[model samples]
Target: MRSPCCDNRGNNNKGAWSKEEDQKLIDYIRAHGRVCWRSLPKAAGLLRCGKSCRLRWINYLRPDVKRGRFEEDEEDLIIKLHALLGNRWSLIAGRLPGRTDNEVKNYWNSHLRKKLASMGIDPDNHRVIHNARLHRSHSSSNATRSSIDKSTNGLQNNSENGFRDDDDLNLDLTISLPSSQRTGSDHLQNTASRTLLLFP
Candidate 1:
């Protein structure tokens, strides 16, 4: 009767590692520097599979690991990198110091994707907001031109009735104001205002 490779007897009586098991694995890896996973459990006196020990050490016990909450800048970088790299979590994690691919993947799935979606930005394509902005600008320009044309047509029609009034000019001014002004929050206020006036 042959036993399974992962059986308790084959694993040297180890299953899920305890805190003590984790400490033993860490200490062994630190002293020995990952010579071989096949030989690690025997060398470290751990009752666990070499593969399990390696995973625990690399994923959880590595000294360079950053275990706390992801910072704001880290979150932003993750979003940008994810946009560029998609689910190539290892590549994204490589750009982020002390963060693991598993950690980054979890954070993206749990937080960053939702945040981008909430901002009306596509997590998969970062250019969604830019495209929307350009579309809105084009539509706004068309609307303003349409309004001006309508006002001009009204004025031409009314020339037969009477002279143009101050109220008519005021209406034109109001209709034209937004076309010459920016539409966004204070963070973009100066840039938008400058662009609107300059471009107009």
Candidate 2:
């Protein structure tokens, strides 16, 4: 069986990575390129678990990984993308060039969640909390009013057939048959003259 990622019994290092460890990982990847995470840790001489090594390289050490603060435009894009895609961080990060899913997720949890809540928006559902409450209140009252209005106006507005008197109630619904049944033959056309059969 394939072993667990960070087997506690093993002497695998945990917590923060040092500069030397980082260099070793970078050097190994630069020379050989990423092969397999499970094998990479031992091959690269890293004491870290394969999962840790992979995360370090992808989220931090990769040359293409964008460092420093996220730009204003990037933040806006993140917010909009989050609204559309919900918690699918990897997909959201895909749009913002060089941003890793971990970085984007951390930024959202640390910064954006609070920022949105401050503006009265529920960070989870991305809805205006106040407006949502108001909407519920208004919806319930409107539903009640609508029910009362329908009951009061039913007799006056509708005839015995449960239809408005002045309304054009056409019971003439047409059904087009298959093309095989609608052939150009005169005898067939005569037999099925109208194509549509009406019922009273």
Candidate 3:
């Protein structure tokens, strides 16, 4: 029977990696440098899928991977970062060297989530445990408020398409007629008359 982790190549094992398999993968990666995981199964003689092998390397077997329990500083930093970044664990992980996003996410869900609750904080909102309030805004910025109101009300002049495509509204042009065309009225005007053209 083949394991889910089995690759196209026949040299690999399936399920959890054995000590022998781990050593083989480690040795191959160290010697050739980590590149082209599809070929890794044949190169390292691993029976596991490329994705599984890659994940194992990144999350567990990386040389710089930190071990043991999370420290107080690490916990505090994770909490502070979680408060700012939310569930984007990868970004948060980047800030904390030697910690993977998966590790941080797991630690947050398993440990810090309970800790926050015990401290009367909402893990989701990161807010102090309190009844929700109707947050009414009594903004003093009347200038901005009035401008918004004006814009809303002024829509009457605009088309249903939400565009102020009215030609009259934009026509502020005054044109002067030529002397030849200006001659009119009682007889002939001595001066050229300026005409204001309004589309409306």
Candidate 4:
């Protein structure tokens, strides 16, 4: 298999691409078209690695790439898609023509995340912060209501059984029966015994 772009780290340039570099890359791609990323850098006379060339071309130098501020509708679509797709920026960018995945991600980090925060929505989960808190409190209230009902039931049971609040009942119960071995008369006797034990 062919080695990765990072394997040849010694000679490749590491910093920002100059206008000359960009022009060379653009011209090469325009003439030959985008092909094998691994071989494209050497063919284009760029000292940068294939991956860097690919990113520069795709993100910046592409003729079709959109520049300037995102439109209002585009912003709304990004919010909606981000809600549904989370951090899948490529998928979100796919829905917006001429937008790059890196652009969308950077926009989210720099702008949209803060925008959502200002609006009291969690950017990560796209939930209203107030609604999330309300849900938690609502759940806790439900639990509190159920506990109150249980305590009331317990008080009623205590009053009926003539027991104090501190008193405890033997609530442990067990049943053992061999249905195949039990005759009709044996079953009746067992039932009668169980009823007496429970009542007493």
Candidate 5:
């Protein structure tokens, strides 16, 4: 079918594509390769627009695109990569050849996220959901700390903060500060401020 994006440049179809349209796209791509999306539709005698053709090819018609349900290994790798990569689905998809970025993103939102939630892990942060409680703790503590600061004129809590509960949350973090930020009385004051995440 032609896509609305085509400006009906002569009854261009839109919405769901037909089997014939799919075949046309596949045959065209198979014959001439999938480059020059902006010119591909006309070259292939399709009413569809270039953008639609590109999406159809990348998400469905491509010879290497995987179909059916995601495998267990893919699910596991998705979780692990998600923990490290967050919403960079393109990067994640690159690791799994034959899997498209949209497919991974959809599977994550529709299925794997729920699976993680069922197991008490946050798919977003890839950490225990309860650790979100730390945010509340941090806020209240900051409030208290603020009040204490007003009263004591510079009092500090340098003992141990709950943010160090990485083992409980199943998170590992490293920190690096620019020399400009790290070299100050902060070193003498024994305060480490806001360099708690470093990933290479």
Candidate 6:
């Protein structure tokens, strides 16, 4: 891997931090409990920038960090948080104790995204749009009333009254029904209910 950008040869003697360097940093931190990052390099005998030292300490050498694969619960929590926060991996990771944002992001891209896509959901929006005829089978009050009126007019006008001219019938058939009758309405309702559950 590339060396950290903060590493400089001219500083406290650049290059990768060895075990001795790590120990020196740890000892200094233990003794001083963290000084200013800009001043830390000189005090700790590190050639790295303040930012680099801080990143190393927080991401790698932190005493509290738990290193390993995430648990099932952690993965589930990450997914739930990601759906709400989108690409804010740090925010998602915040809900997962002992997990890092980088780790969560990688898992999302590699595993969860694929799983969602395979299930016909848009990984980006977490919604599925299938072109089924049931989705087209909606009904509207005006439409239902019109159909009832047309049928009544046809019955009253004559045997042909219940039936309209082929062209007229075809035109009426093009009207969209209400979305509640659509095949996906149940799914949409479920999603809405889940959202309500989350908040309330």
Candidate with the larger lDDT of 1 and 4:
4
Q: Compute the lDDT of residue 56 as modeled in candidate 1.
A: 75
The all-Cα superposition gives candidate 3 an RMSD in Å to the true structure of 23.7
Q: Per-residue lDDT for 112-134 in model 6, tens only?
A: 77655554445665444354222
* Residue 51 displacement in candidate 6 (angstroms): 1.2
Candidate 6's C-alpha runs over 4 A off are: 1-17, 129-200
> Ten-residue segment with the worst summed lDDT in candidate 2?
191-200
Q: Write the per-residue lDDT of candidate 3 for residues 1-200, one digit (tens) a residue.
A: 76754444655466787898889889999999998987796778877778878988988899988877988667766765565446868756765678888999999999878766655556764554666432224232233223322433343244653445332222222422333333445222224232222112
In model 4, pairs of residues that clash are none
In order of appearance, the predictions have TM-scores of 0.55, 0.63, 0.58, 0.63, 0.61, 0.54
Model 3 whole-model lDDT (C-alpha atoms): 0.62
lDDT by residue for model 2 (1-200), tens: 99776766668898999999999999999999888888888898988888899999999999988988988667766665565457878766866778899999999999877666655556665554665333223443344333323432332256664556333322222332233334444122234222222112
> For residue 136, what is the lDDT in candidate 4?
25
Clashing pairs in 5: 2-13, 2-14, 3-13
Q: Relative to the unseen true structure, what is the Cα RMSD of model 1?
A: 20.2
Q: Candidate 1: which stretches are off by over 4 Å?
A: 1-16, 127-200
- Candidates 1 and 3 compared: the better one by TM-score is 3
lDDT tens per residue, model 4, 146-197: 3433433353356555656543322222222234334555432332221212
Residue 120 of model 5 has an lDDT of 49
Rate residue 121 of model 1 by lDDT: 55
CA shift at 46, candidate 5, in angstroms?
1.2
* Candidate 2 colliding pairs: none
